[model samples]
Target: MTSRAAQEEGVQFGLADTGNSIPVGLVTGIAAAALAAGAALVWWMRRRRTTRG
Candidate 1:
């Protein structure tokens, strides 16, 4: 770990544990939406297969 001054001087890169830039709320919403979409697609595929058979 280096001081902020050193980082600013471009002596080190990505060596610090800088906090996440993305908001937790936004991440949670995106994950939830993806899960719901995936579930709906799976359900639709199963229904279509059953009807055709």
Candidate 2:
């Protein structure tokens, strides 16, 4: 019984790890795009405010 439980636990742990495996390149690209978009938005807002004021 103990051996069976250990085997099942190991299988579950492996599946969990694999489920979280994401491509690093994809993650980095998304982060870079979001950061660039945020910066552009801030710059636009500040420029608009300055022009109005």
Q: Best candidate, lDDT-wise?
A: 1
Whole-model Cα lDDT of every candidate shown, in order: 0.88, 0.83
What TM-score does prediction 1 earn?
A: 0.64
For candidate 2, the per-residue lDDT at 49 reads 98
Candidate 1: which stretches are off by over 4 Å? 1-19
> Could you estimate the TM-score for every candidate?
0.64, 0.66
Point out where model 2 deviates above 4 Å: 1-4, 8-15, 18-20
Q: Assess candidate 2 and give its lDDT.
A: 0.83
Measured by TM-score, how close is model 2 to the native structure? 0.66
How many clashing pairs per prediction, in order?
A: 0, 0
Worst 10 residues of 2 by lDDT: 11-20
Q: What is the lDDT of residue 25 in candidate 1?
A: 97
Candidate 1's residue-wise lDDT over 1-53, tens digit each?
Answer: 46788878877665576558979999899999999999999999999999999
